[model samples]
Target: MEAKFQIFLILLAVLAGTALLARRINVAPAILLMLAGIALAFVPGMPTVELPPELVLLVVLPPLIYSASVAMSWREFKSNLRPIILLALGCVIFTAFAVAAATHYLIGLPWAVGFLLGAIVAPPDVVAPLAIARKLGMPRRILVVLEGEGLANDATALILYRFTAAAITTGLFSLPKATGTFAVIVVCEIVFGVAVGWLSLRARHHARDPQVEITLSLITPYLAFWIPEHFGGSGVIATVACGLYISWNGPLLISSATRLQGIFFWDLIIFLVEGLLFLLTGFQMRLLFEKSKAFPLEDILIATALVAIIVVVARFAWVYPATYLPRLISKRIRERDPAPNWRTVFVISFTGVRGAVSLAAALALPLALPSGEAFPHRDMILFVAFGVIFITLVGMGSGLPLVARWLDITRDGRDEHRAEHEAEIAARREVLAAALQSLDAITDDRRLSDEVVKLLRARHESRTNQLPDSLDPDAYDVSAAGTALTRELIAAERKFIHVLLRDGKITDETRRRIERDLDLEEASLSNREFRKIAL
Candidate 1:
């Protein structure tokens, strides 16, 4: 067995355990994985483990992003398309330039490498925002916007990174060519994504078996990702497109069982990918440093701080202006409601937590350029990007609640949710009442067994307390529904027992024993009741 594979297995277990623990504790797992990796690297008898840079993004991202896309609701993403695009594409470009400019002068790095660093760290982590938004129980609108942004931003950032890397390697930067390349990449990515998505939907339309359908859905993301990359398009975009397309079309084509099974299977795959990716980031950072020894530690530290500030500040610049621009344009053009509110802007801005992609891109930088010389500023770029991710994610992430409180967003949101929750409960209670009384009837047996009548009366009295006045008379009266539903249950049970007996699945002795058991309490059952009463 290879040492790296052994390390990989151990890290997998460690990350999975840490992730579960973090979920239980209601905190982000990114911090836990990073700490664990660093600890493992330092521990005795733990071989210094480093993941292959080429494998980090290639092996992990397609599944992670695809799983996230699967989990997102299509309706939510569709409704907030504008804001998501602005942040994912527009804000990404803005941030890239801001960071590039800041790093260019501050770090004394060449123009291309600095911009490459910017591009590398441009997109905030999809895993981070998606996890936090879900955990915080943010509104669907907010979550969808974040999710959509995360999904799209990576494509933009990766394209920029490619061009930036090319310029640095070749020492020839053409504005016209880069612009054309950017446009072409974006268009091709979208086209590929749509095509793949359409294919997924087509596959599901023809699939009949739940097992086969789910297996096909599991395969869709990788196919979408690899195909686009193969064709010089954005794999990330292709994966997202396919995931979104399949999910949207699933209700139309896929069976209920297939959707349910796919959710669980894909969720597990995502958990594994995300957990392993973060852990790998920490270890890989050390490898980049070890290989790029010419870069001084102080230089790396300073560059990191500079890039982190740029990333953080760039968000503020992009968010505030972009948030309001839609509203202004809407007054004349589309004439729609403006973008998010001021508080939402704050929430959105602070939610920019960098994660795996930035680290992966940094690690993916060529060890030596086409010139056969060590990649200039490669160590610094990786170190700074990692630092940006760590500080922004841990620093702002830990303080998110505080920021919300400071803006008075948390308290107001809590109160609103509380009221909304109470209303939902009230509504649900009404529904239950209606569902119950749906089975209500006027009893014809005036001389019904005294004990049975007395039990029925008591149950009816209990129903008044449980069922609110708003409920119609035919509402969720348990006793009434039970009276109607219990007979079906009895018939099913009789059939089951009869089937067993006829098939010799049960013996006469066993039947008698069961009959004796069931004869004692005659069950009180309902339409949905699936179990049987034993004698």
Candidate 2:
């Protein structure tokens, strides 16, 4: 792994550059960073770097998934949890088997190795899409589905991959045993995850300060993951469960200051982990390429294509049926929302993209068997895995915009028009209605003593044409930057104080004063955002 300080600086530069460029080009910043990392790999003198598999998978992945899941609106997640799990577990298994069979026949790889590859590529990278989707006004329903899927698919994929990889290595395949193990892994992971989350909340309850509370939350993910993995269970599942538990319990047990601070703290952790993984992919992967210098490129391409096909097709199978699952049970969903039309299904199906998890799982394969013989076709695996990532990240990256546009799924252009039209109309209506009402009531009294009414009449009579939907922009813009970030900071500081007071870090009197100050600041900030949007 690269030095922490150097990695941090590099990530900052990458983030800043990507942010600026994304604003200019109007695309996801993460997409830009991924491309930049790929480009950096081929440049001279940038030493190839390999991230430790444990660090990337265990250390980086848990918090990354947990943070995203924790931040999700629980109401939405609870409603959509079934479909998301189906997509993650059911779909992943389907893809693995489908791809495994396809790879065995088409590419002539061992069935087990083929399954391993399929499992690797099954999970989606929801982070990039979620961040981009927010700006695009993506429906909350879709966002929750994607978030839940990403948070969970790893457990399915990793467990399947582990068993399949072990069988491939030892030549001891057992379907019944693997199935049994899978069941155990699922149960243990869920139980352990809930346990860790509960304990973390308990610790926070007794903590002495907001900063300490936040730190405890930070440590919980890794702890949740390690404890489960050490016991031969799915760490991924445990961590996600823990995250959801704590998040759901947060409003009740956590100080508001701790709650807000914990979110941003985890967010930064996720950003760094995701960013560094991509960068390391650029670096460490070159070694595998060099070691496999003689591997044929055409073979790699064929395998990648086959694997990609299975991954996409599995989602279609899972989603088409899932879109209507609400009909099966009562109290399961909010309402009988219309099923996703074919166009929407097409977009959702194609959302499958191989990413960091796939790459890490593929790379984690042992180089040689217990007898010291070389792993079968290891180079081919690497080549295809890397190829899949490249094609998916870049190829699918380029296509998403086109697909969205064709489906008329984009909200940007329409939203702007609606907003602009409404603002103009509302402003006019308010001003003119005020003026006319004042004039009509004051005319008879004006000669006697109607000065105040005249002033009111002047204020109201200014405008006749007002849009019913529009509001004044002036009322919204409180800060130079939008209310989104500043308001959050105020709330966060308030949370810190709340945690402090609860944990005995601060006196109730001081805490009240600090909280009152924050409440005022946050209220003003929120008003500004509303005003900005309304105007």
lDDT values for all models = 0.73, 0.73
For all predicted structures, in order, the TM-scores are: 0.77, 0.77
Instruction: Report model 1's TM-score to 2 decimal places.
Output: 0.77
Worst 10 residues of 2 by lDDT: 462-471
> Candidate 2, residues 1-535: lDDT per residue as tens digits?
3575775687678767766887898876666776777676667876666657777787788778778667766677777777787888888888888888898998788887888888877777776666665565544566677788888888898888888888877889888998998888888888888999899888998894799998887788889888878877769988888888877887788887776666667667776677667766656557766856686767666777877766777778777776666554554453545566576567667777677777788778898999899888777777777777767776776577777777766553345545644675566566677657656766665664467666765544532311122334442332334456766677688778878888998899998888877776775444333333411
Q: State residue 367's C-alpha deviation in candidate 2, in Å.
A: 0.6
> What's the true lDDT of residue 382 in model 1?
72
Candidate 1 displacement at residue 464 in angstroms = 17
Q: In model 2, how large is the Cα lDDT of residue 527?
A: 36
Provide the clashing-pair count of each candidate structure. 12, 17
TM-score, model 2 to reference: 0.77
Clashes of 1: 12
